[model samples]
Target: MLCYEELREAVDNGYIIGDTLNVVRKNGKVFDYALPGEPVRPWEIVTVESLIDIMTELSNYQ
Candidate 1:
C-alpha cells in the first residue's frame, strides 16, 4: 500500500493521534510537512495492523 494511503487510513480509523507524518517516497526521499509552531510529532497507532507493519519493517532491518 502507498504510504500516504496507509497514513490516511490510520487517521480515519482513529488509530493514530497527536502526531504528524513524514512519508518516505519510493525514490528514497523523506517528505515532511508541518506548521510553523504546531510542531506535531509522529502519529500514534492504536491498531494492531499498524503494529504489524512496524514489526515487519523492523525485521527487515534485522
Candidate 2:
C-alpha cells in the first residue's frame, strides 16, 4: 500500500493514471480506497488511520 507522501507524489507526478477512483468511507471518514477497475466492497472492513493523518498533512499544506 502506498503511504500518504508517496500517494501525493504519485498524484502530483501524474503516475496514478486511471479513469475511475473509488474512495470508500465509513462513519463519514475515509476507510479505504480502490484504483480504477479495482473491485471493492461498499462496506468498511478496517479503520484507516491514514485518513486523519492525511487530513492533518493537508491542513499543514494550507
Candidate 3:
C-alpha cells in the first residue's frame, strides 16, 4: 500500500488507471486524490470502500 500523496502523483502521471485496480469500481473509473474542482486537478470519485481494502491490507503487514 502507498500513501495518498504518492498515489495521487502516480495517478497524475497516468500510472494508475482502470487496469491498476482490483478493488470494486465506482462509476467505472479509478482515482488517486484531488481537491474538488481545482481547475488543474479536480477531485474524482475516489471510493471509501476501495480505500478500506487498501488500508486493511496495509494493517495486516509486518
Residue-by-residue lDDT tens digits, candidate 3, 1-62: 34445554655787555423333233553333333333332333343345445544434442
lDDT of each: 0.40, 0.51, 0.43
Model 3 stretches with alpha carbons more than 4 Å out: 19-62
Off by over 4 Å in 1: 20-62
Model 3 clash number: 0
Q: Runs in model 2 with CA error above 4 Å? A: 1-6, 10-15, 18-20, 42-62
**lDDT digits (tens) for residues 1-62 of candidate 2:** 33456556655687554533345555555444555566666454533344445445444543
Error of 1 at 45 (Å): 17
Candidate 2 displacement at residue 30 in angstroms:
1.5
- lDDT score for candidate 1 against the true structure: 0.40
Candidate 1, residue 2: Cα displacement in angstroms equals: 5.7
Pairs of residues at least 3 apart in sequence or in different chains that clash in candidate 2? none
How many clashing pairs per prediction, in order?
A: 0, 0, 0
TM-score of every candidate relative to the true structure: 0.29, 0.40, 0.31
